[model samples]
Target chain A: MSTPLLYALTGAVLWGIGLMGLIGLRHLLRKLLALNLIGSATFLILVGLAQHHNGPDPVPQALVLTGIVVSIAATALGVVLIRRYFHLTGRTELESEVPEAGRDEEGHSG
Target chain B: MSNWLMAGLLFTPLALATVSLLLGFRQGRALSWLGMLLQLLVSVGLWWLVRHEGGFYYTLAGWDAPLGIELRVDGLVVTFLLLTTLVASGCGIHAGFYLEPDRPWQRYFWPLYWFLWAGLNTVWMGGDLFNLYVGLELITLSAVGLVALGGQAEALRAALRYLLAALLGSLAYLLGVALVYGQFGTLSLADVAGQVRVSEHALLMRPALVLMLVGLALKTALFPLHGWLPPAHGIAKSPVSALLSALVVKASFYIAARVWLEAGVAVASQWMAQLLGVLGAVAIIWGSWLALCQPRLKQVVAYSSVAQIGYLFLLFPLTFGVEASVSLHAQQGITLQVISHALAKAAMFLAAGNLILAVGSNRVEALAGVSHFLPFSLFSFGLAGVSLMGLPPSGGFAAKWMLLQASMASGQWWWIMVLAGGGLLSAAYVFRIYKASFLERDEQDHFYHPDRRLEVAAMLLALASLGVGVSGSQVLSVMAMPFEEVQ
Candidate 1:
């Protein structure tokens, strides 16, 4: 396979793995890391595609640059939120969702 | 002149947000209010310009497409711009009173709120795919921050969940945009639409559309993927909840509609349309059922949003399933639904927030003495609830009327049943609130006297929701849909 094709495949695999981790992981920090992994996978695929042309595509480069910045901001904010969540309650996982049939099923008192 | 106004439509909020951030709350709140009022004027100016001179596309910084970004002003954009201006202004005014200006929170809230407004305007006006990704990020981040402003543990946890889920959605959307750009060699919506119409790179485009649509669905909180919505929208402060419910979700959904109707309509098939309708149907029934079960007032409204959003999905089927002539009607119907929902939902949240503030609790049972104490706000809530229930002389009723007509005309009788059932279910929850509020209490519970200005602001929005129904016919004419008009 060509270099771009291989990189694209690897990126796709990383995305799949990251998504699986995001869904499967119960730890808040792990979930945030999984989300970052997905972001990296997307950026990698974008960079790979940018090289598909004879020279690097400027548009995708600009997009990736901006994407990296946005992803950083999002990750930073997420970390702050998780830190506070941990500070408030020592747990990392979200309050385990009760079954749909559980008692809080009705209007809950705040 | 209009071009400059168009640019102002995009940048004024950005400038105001920066100014507010630096100036702090004392000066920031006044400037934010002025910025919103200015946006209202600019939005109307753009709407009039689009209506009179027809929609136009301008390249940012004099750069052409496939290179520089584009800002598009069209019927869809105009309609949404108007919604953003009106609902945002109302929410801002309510928030001004909702949070005491003296509190340090104002320093934080005003800046983020304006940033969110700026982001919403970008979503509506951005013609380039990358710009939209940026816009969605702005909305998501600002919205998550707003949800966590109260600093409670529950609020923080919910914000974290929302941040993760929303980021995942954005990444997925970005991946789709990347794939589309790689295949089509362009990122502008118009350019992409042209490419997709000729079925160029049909293979790549299909997956791209799937990724984008699925991501948007998650962000929009449709059906099963909506696990993050109730918590995020419920735990936030009242004005924050109102903004999130009223406008934040709609930004992503607007992009979805723009893609489906404008760019990828040809690639989208009958089954895909039907699939959206089915998911919507389930969201309606499931959301309403959950809303009925909610013990707190805010949760009921939040779940009701999930159900109300289902009504919007039905538009996908109604638009693409039928003939071209029939699709126009469906298009108008869905647009009406969007606007009316914004008005009614914003009004409901503001009023509910007012009631909750006065009663010092969100439990429905705690609202017994509220009607007696804050009758005006309660009256506002009732009017807003009337619209929510799709009762007569309200925006929600008008939207439902149009959707009903479109479904009938398109012969999609199944959706008709869903609409009817959803409305009745909405009535059940709305009525539940009404019933609780009307109950005669044994002991007199003291209610906090809400700010008079805040109550008036809430009343104004509720009345506007009712007024929109009276002028419902103008909706189709005002939107002036380019695609349907051409047909």
Candidate 2:
């Protein structure tokens, strides 16, 4: 198989595995990691495709570059939110127990 | 004049935001307000120009499409641009009173807010796929930074989760673009639209469409891919939450819609559109159910966003059936719905922020008798809810009306059921908050009187949501102008 086709197949497999991991994993952090793997797979596919005909397509490469930067920024923000949640409740999974309505035990009443 | 105004409108916020970063926390608040005021003035000026002179296109570095970036200001772009600037400015104004004056994070918020403004405008004006991707990155990065701006441990965690999802989404989009470029050798959306031939590479095209749609779905936080949204949106300070929900997610969806209409719809399978519509329907119901169950006020609003976004996705299946007037109506309805939702949701988040400030808590139950403490905020919340609930004399009502008509006309009454059911669910949750706010509590309320300026800003947004209903015809006319040929 040609390199682009090989890359596309690998990307498809990685995406499938990553999605499976996302579905199976309960921990938010783990799910995020799975997502990242899927993202990396996608980048590989894009870069491979852009290399078609022995010449790189600047357009797709440019887009991938932009996408990479965006992904990092979003990852930074997501980490911050995860940290906040962990501090507040001491767990990574979404809090199942809804806080009672009338209390400010969390000290965030304001 | 128009071209320069467009550039200024897009870049001035970034310039001001950058300057604020250098100034640090001491002068951040003042700088933020100044930046906001400048953005508002520029947006208004651009809106007027678009109104009077029709849309204008600006090619960066004097290079045209297929080579350099192109920013085209159409009715849709102008409307969204106006919305972003308005919401950002309002949030800026509101943040002044909402955030502690001495908070160290103020230094970061102002510059990021402006960067976000510049990104939003660029995304709105972007004429091609690559340009759109650039705008998307700018938006994603700035938004991620904003989420982490809170700097609390939980906030950091949530920001990380959001970051991963965004990255994955961007990657998927990039892959799709690469596939298209390999097949067609063009980056310009218009060029791709003209060049794409379905028969030559059906298999390749299908996967590309799937990748692009899935990526956008994740970014838009469509039902199953919505893991990052609730915590990220809910935990962020109210102003940031408003922008993230009201504008940022919509930017991705806007691009997806444009791409689908311009390229994918013509060459892709009808089943794909139907599949998207199905997902949207699922999201509407699932999101509403989840929102109804949330304990926190902000979480409730965040979940509602998932449901509302589903309605926007329904436009995909409805837009492709050229012979069907019902599909056309559905398209129009979805367009109107998008605008109305943006306005209403922004207002709702702002009002929720004010209530949280007043009650000194984010918990919904603790808001007993909050209406008495902050009557205006409550009033604004309720009014915005009117739109969310699709009640009469509200833009939400007009949007739903069109949607219902389209459903009936198209005989796609299953979607009608979803729309109606979603509305009921929305009403249920809204009323839950309304009931909680009005409960008679005898204790003296310890109100954290939010800055009057912020309250006014929130109310102004709420009023704007209501005003959309009055100006529905005008807005629809504008949305209708683009894709007239397609219709």
| Alpha carbon lDDT of each predicted model | 0.84, 0.77
Worst 10 residues of 2 chain B by lDDT: B478-487
Candidate 1 residue lDDT tens string, B79-135: 888888888999998888788777676688887998899899888889889899999
Best by TM-score: 1
Candidate 2 residue spans exceeding 4 A from truth: A10-40, A51-110, B197-202, B322-328, B480-487
Error of 1 at A45 (Å): 1.7
Clashing pairs in 1: A106-B293, A106-B295, A107-B293, A107-B294, A107-B295, A107-B296, A108-B295
Give residue B367's lDDT in candidate 2 (0 to 100): 92
Per-residue C-alpha lDDT of model 1 across residues A1-110, encoded as one tens digit per residue: 88777877899999998988887777778888888899999988887865778867777777788898998899899888888888888888775453431222111221
- The DockQ values of the predictions, listed in order, are 0.47, 0.31
lDDT score at residue B480, model 1, on the 0-100 scale: 76
lDDT of 2 by residue, B97-134 (tens): 67775766667887888888888888888887777877
Q: Which docking category, incorrect, acceptable, medium or high, applies to candidate 2?
A: acceptable
Model 1 residue A17 lDDT?
A: 89
